[model samples]
Target: METESFEDKGGWVIDQQSFVVMNSSYIMAHGMGRPVKDAATTVKFPKTGKYHLWVRTKDWAPFPKGPGKFQVLVDGKSVGQTFGESGSDTWKWYDGGLVDIRNANIKLALKDLTGFNGRCDALLFTDDLKFTPPNELEALTAFRRKLLNLTDKPQEAGRYDLVVVGGGIAGTCAAISAARMGLTVALIQDRPVLGGNNSSEIRVHLMGDVDKNHYPKLGRIVREMDNGDPGNGNPDAKEYGDARKISIVKAEKNISLFLNTHVFKVEKENDIITAVVGRDIATNQERRFSGSFFSDCTGDGTVGFLAGAEFRMGRESKAETGESLAADQSDDFTLGTSNLWASVDRDTVSSFPETPWAMQFSDEYHIDEPKSDWQWETGFGNFNTITQAEQIRDHNLRAIYGNWSYLKKNKAAKYGKKELAWVAYIGGKRESRRIIGDYVLNQMDIQEGKFYPDGSVTATWTIDLHFPDAKNSKYFEGQEFFAGTKHIKVAPYTIPYRCLYSKNIQNLFMAGRNISTTHVAFGSTRVMRTCGMMGEVVGFASYIAAKYKTSPRGVYKDHLAELTGILKGETLAPQP
Candidate 1:
């Protein structure tokens, strides 16, 4: 038997899911009826013979009709029918008939039948047709490991002084800061590109000021990596500056950047993370990275989740956090995720087909033209943006297409010449699990400007939280698909070094939205530029931890002076 996981698909996304523990990561095509190119991988047969192809997928909805469906193709020939058309709402394997193998080289391809979302966890080919794959997790894991020749315990990819997970602006800055200090570093990102939300995929324009904060050189790397284009919403590659960011990371000598790698496992002992295991999304292979220090730049706090670090989700009550702006009583309600889009103006007339399956807006709220900024957001008021990521994305996509359809079908003359420039398949998230650290910064901290002895990076953005659009909320109630933000301004405040390290997990340092902060303070700290500065501070602190061979918390408790020196751009000498 031979197997291939779509996680290894280079030009694809590994969307977040809670209802499914998929054998492979799945991609959601958000183009509505327009066909989007899917993922592909090559396989070599040990011996040429007939092979029965099977795919691991699900209908997602069993009672009604399934929205997700796709077909299998071998050597450019269809295996006959779409596999995800009919199956249990739960995950299951489906047969794709037999194909005679004439050549050693094989090309496996997926054709998305439904533009909504056609998911496939893995593709399997077996010599014995009766040998059905197992549905259970343990059995399936062993089956795929053996079939794919993957080690249950991954082999070491390399040893690094520091390993930064999540290749957003935060992770990028961390790697550069540490590597420039002569520390060997590894930066692992799930997506093909860096910049996280600001990447071409998500397109959130970077906010906040650099050099104005306590640390002048904190966002130096951010500015260097940026293409300097302030435009948003499907701007040109030059505007997004993807190439420049990649070039900067590639040029670093002390850094080993791993792109398209999903970090899934960790090895820890006595609260110290010894190594991290990342699976190459395109090949289903694994690589283990050993490090003395680790940074969680993942906005969702995934590393903390895998490592058993203490974290907080949703809002903290006004009583618990003592913030007047917080909810009277807290529950799991975050800012939610956004799927944004834009349109292009051409010399000739163009048309967009009406999308019948998209999310709806009231006739008055129906979008006529295109949007090119961050305001085109959705998924709020108790929406599970992390677990129900795909569903939330679909809701946004539906809203996009449904509104466009309303304009095209009812008011054609106005939008007849406009064509879709881009619609992000990737969803931009604002908040998730904030891993517990030595200090939980709250509204009081930012408002009072309480400075710590270990104060490092400064936060500049206002406390901004998104709720459902008031009018849209009136119409859709619980399923509103538009965002309305409430911004509370505050003076620039410093984040303590204690806020960067995991409280329970010793070696793990966290940056970005997942850093230790109350919901209200997270509003200001969650900005990309502020997160980038957190990375810069964490990088230097990581170097101190390695230099003194101490735990992350030890950097503050025992070596604050040296860490403070780095943050203040003082002497290079270490003091412990």
Candidate 2:
């Protein structure tokens, strides 16, 4: 049985961030070092007898011992051995010995031993002791489907003029802009909410200026959904405007918004994408969406990657990109992800338990702030923002909890009344796979204010690159959680439309941080409002492509003038 499908989740939260790498969404016990309440469910056995149980879990921190230890309870009885104490880092099945089942209907529960981000993917009970579950993701997926009676074929979701994957600020703007221009659009989001980092789940306020670009009306749609500058990692949930964003998308009659739907498969012919397949996060039911054109706004370039689009993940060498800001040598050193958190002052003093399993912090070396903001970040250098996402998030959580514990213990007088009000589980990612395009935007293009004829979206943010703070490194070393940034100011430069569509994939368009930009140029273009404008350009380009029956490249080569006119507030077609 899938642990995520438990009747009562209790304190365990559904984490789908690493679903791409892990293959399935798992439940995490994020009780801040305290043991979380049991996640209980009822299951029926085929026959009443002795059964061997296998639990799919991982040792998140497998150094000395796994901190994420948990037990599987059958009818409120322990399943012999601890599940997450296998000492292996990868996700594997741990033998839970055997349990005698007297009744067909029995109570099953996951008892979290220590709340240091313990996770459970699924569980299996077999009458045959010799049988073992598949460890490989592909084989395991087939095994799960056959066991659960899930169909291999996906249900049709309907055809669209444009299919926009990811419901972040960029994807939202893309769908809204296309819908306003009379395109039947499908906007798919993996999360329950519309906004990504800007959503209440992450609470990062929107950055970059809107409506200050060459194209005056380019950011109008983005401005309509703007939640104002609430600041990063704000404790107030209402400040980020989740309802406003969803309502605006729902108001568009031409757009079909799919929330909690994660697109994982892509169907292509020759070099053009034909359809994309997604699975519902809760039900695991797959749906297929066909479109004339597709947009990869998934920040990680998920759709593009599946469609065989050429992409880059690490920073380019200075010799290769001819940018001074580029790294000395091309390496896997992309910007990190942030899991921001905050604390609140309470009327009564609150006590926090010491987290011995977490990263130990002393009075001399600890973040002495009441809350976390952008500075509290992780996943840099060797750490991959995609494959190692869960580890990065857990590392950030360790830092937050460990630092809070230190503050509470050392400076009781100052922090005794403070309580952790909010902590973001969904990571605010900065850099990942950058889908290659016709013209790659570089650092010199932004710094020297270089102009292209097809300049569509104006980027106003600075070339802000983050690195591990020297002070933080002194304490945490290679596992540093804190970050420092150097913002290099630049004149507002228009990003070329050539950077918006894929070079190899015929009909693929991109926006957000995953746009065709060097690691250095992404420092400026990664902000939400700038990405929103990129989406606007993609939307207009999609209209031109649909109208003229051309590819994204065809729009640039032939219908450039028409796309520019549409961007400049000249309505090409009436809203349907």
Candidate 3:
């Protein structure tokens, strides 16, 4: 293959979708209104010749005319072809006709026509259209390696004692804790930064109590990492503190941090996961990370999914989990994702576009203008947070825009002078795909205050379950974008270590909301800081696993005493 492909760099904001062209994909000029700045990437052509430029893009919504549309620029000149508006559900390379490039240096830019998410996976220039690479994952992976001249083995990025798959509060603490224990660690995050939901992109302030009773060291790192307020962001004029989390991760010298890399596939040996395959979001370069143990901090239990681990999604029946909070009968409806937005009181009156595509809300569900925060959430109606994440986020965006538009068009005093200061396309998800472990924590464990020998990570938040807003669900029917929560108070209780690792997959451990908790119990344990504590416990357990050459279950079965000491701060290595 004489064609060389280039991945879109930082100019485009990422839009997360599971089972996409790559595990990671980008959206140009997302969440903002029509503007002029171009999302550009510089590429050096290997040979000077006339070649057909084909862009791999998708029409996210499978309508006649797609929601997103963009133009490709060659050497600052428009290619005259509007991409994304024409492709189907499957991402295929669209021919931008023929283009002549005499010089090696060529600048490719994405000029957006619609503010809707215009996605671009890769751009490949080839002389022959019939000889291009296949779009299937396996074939595509091999072709990418060959085109980039990458090794067949995926090129070992690093071998560590521990590899944490998610970079949320939990994954960060997991990596930090393991690094402090004199273990080499790798922290891989799909997004550009750490702190996952708490990161400014999502802007969910760290929740759950820090420096709690069961274990002080449990949330010690979280206390340090927790910056800004509880809602979306610094509600005041001040900016959100994302740099603090990055600073903490960078300060840990014993860890190799891979940001903007998504781990989509796993290499397993029987029940043990030997390695994980990750692709860089920016460069599209594939790397294999080898480790003694791996943590599925990737909130949807992504690592566990690829490794074929036994996992449960959505709620359990009242009879199954034996919790009153459980549904009458179990189905696939889990806690929905929160897509939050904030508006500032402008000095002058501002206007917003009418959101025709958004779901309609009744008077009861109608949001008051200039007053949106964590309360403005969506995605409980028939939407799967994993497969349908893009739709879920877009649905939220439409609701937010429509609400603002109604208020502005109607000339309401509440939002007459208000302007949308910030709106996030990145959805802050709560629950999905809980990897099955030895212990499936139920509400009875927390409410009954049942103590286990391997208890770790205290639960603080109530059994908060989110449902579709009654009025909104009635109006929108199957596509409700408004949600409401049901909370059940409970005394703080500890989560057992057995709930942290996969029951079938031996080397795989889990943290965050995906830990082995019954749906009802997860309602309380799903907060950011509480998830961090789970990560801390798993991190200590990983060290013990590496130290004793034990499996995750082995750490619990044989070394629970040592693991208890670590959680209690006795075995914690002094923080750097």
Candidate 4:
């Protein structure tokens, strides 16, 4: 049992003579501050049996202050995990023991998880003195072994009738609805906050029947988000009403909130999801949750996809679905992203811009050009949205600054040298991957005023599609900006429950812009208010499945009357 180390000019080393190396094994550098991968140096196991893995840290310098994290992987899957505790010396070593080392290639990954920032170390592999690598036969037996640890222990397995995978407006409502009806629920969220897009992170002002003159049920949740005060022209203040309301909802007792956590994998037993793997991003800890029923309200359909739920993405061709509004469809080409900006009244600000702004203005910044305005930031409606967001956000900042700069440099416009104060921290994405559901809502449904007695949510926006050629049209026809084929804003349409469940997988649901809808129908259904309602609907459905000990399909069928009764009672105000 000897160790050998070689140093290259690149400040990293490897032990070529280790006994653990198998055919496909190689040492590679990944993450911050490491040289590229090196060629393979194979090591043949003398005789196969159980083996222990010890990973040594190889850093350029002594250990710095604070804790650090690194990952050791077998084949490509993560196995051994280590953390550097405070007060540890530089280049500290940690041992990953008794791993069922069966993979042909075992590698170590050093990652920096600290906020202050540092680089990962090169890995030094060594052999276990007590045991040896397992043989092919032994490895086959080990492969069948399930890796169960305390981290994966369920606090309550199959105990909760339902599990909701998001804590947004829809998730919260669903959890409350189910819990109030005497069903156990597990509410999961990836953020510290419960609200999804409308959370404080994105900071979009809430809209719906909540603030409207006739609808107060729409306002029920929003009023809870208010500060209970009055303000002028400020949508957040008028909409939220008071800050105290937000505090109360955050303290809701029925919801078992797991924020700042992400669902990574799902385990299936027969056609049912037995457990879900979750990771707490902040702590780097992993856990498992088990429930009889599950609802996916991640907006992006993340959970549903992982659970092997059947879902679709992007628009289907008209020929395929007879969706009328569907055109020649492609994949990965979703809606645009919006970098929302808030304006500060110049009268309250004490500073002025020290530079010029705009593209040669003559006191008139308003134009019919295919562009955006900072006065009222509105986007998320562009072709090539992924790439365009980066361009639009940057251009938006530049335009605002450039405009202010021009005023300061010019004598007219009387803006008195104003400049942009700040940009939004979170960029809102209007559309992305949509989950294919059992039924995809179509454009004709909205046009014909079709109604599903089982409809859980309604959408009122028009079939607004951004032009394909933004830069060359009457506006920027070829540019990546808002371009709608038409605006059919006349009628409101219902989103059915079947369109949310997976077409192939059982017990999985999706909400938000990702739900099953044609691109045209999505343009109308993609709004946050509608998404919130969808969320609530999914949440309630999940609760019913858990309570009745049935599947979501069963709830949509035999229990339709009961489900509708509950939804109607949850109504915020009397319907017009």
The most accurate candidate by lDDT is: 2
Q: What tens digits encode model 3's per-residue C-alpha lDDT throughout 383-497?
A: 8888888777766776776677776766557777877766776788887899999999998898877678888887778888888778776777776766787678888788899
lDDT of 1 by residue, 1-576 (tens): 222354234334455343235545555444455655766667788889988877777765433455566677777788897766584656677877887888898787777765655666777778896888898888987887787788677867899999999999899999988888779999999878999988988888788777677766577776786666566666454577787788898889988989878888888997788999988766667899998889999888888888999999988898898799999999888888877777766778766664444555455766555664565666554566666676666667667777876776676577777776677778888888999998999998888777778887877788898787787777768867777887888887899989998999989998888999998888888888788888888888888888888988988899998887776678564321
Best by TM-score: 2
TM-score per prediction, in order, is 0.91, 0.96, 0.90, 0.60
Output the lDDT of residue 85, model 1: 56
Screening candidate 1 with a backbone cut-off below 3 angstroms (N, C-alpha, C), the clashing residue pairs are 7-281, 8-281, 8-282, 8-283, 9-282, 358-398, 359-398
Model 1 sits at a Cα RMSD from the real structure of 3.3
Separately for all candidates shown, the number of backbone clashes (residues 3 or more apart, or on different chains) is 7, 0, 0, 47
Runs in model 4 lying further than 4 Å from the true structure: 1-159, 207-251, 329-331, 346-419, 467-486, 570-576
Model 4 sits at a Cα RMSD from the real structure of 13.6
| Residue pairs of candidate 3 with colliding backbone atoms | none
From the highest TM-score down, the ranking of the candidates is 2, 1, 3, 4
Relative to the true structure, how large is the alpha-carbon lDDT of every model? Answer: 0.77, 0.90, 0.77, 0.50
| CA error at residue 92 for candidate 1, angstroms | 3.0
Residue pairs with clashing backbones, model 2: none
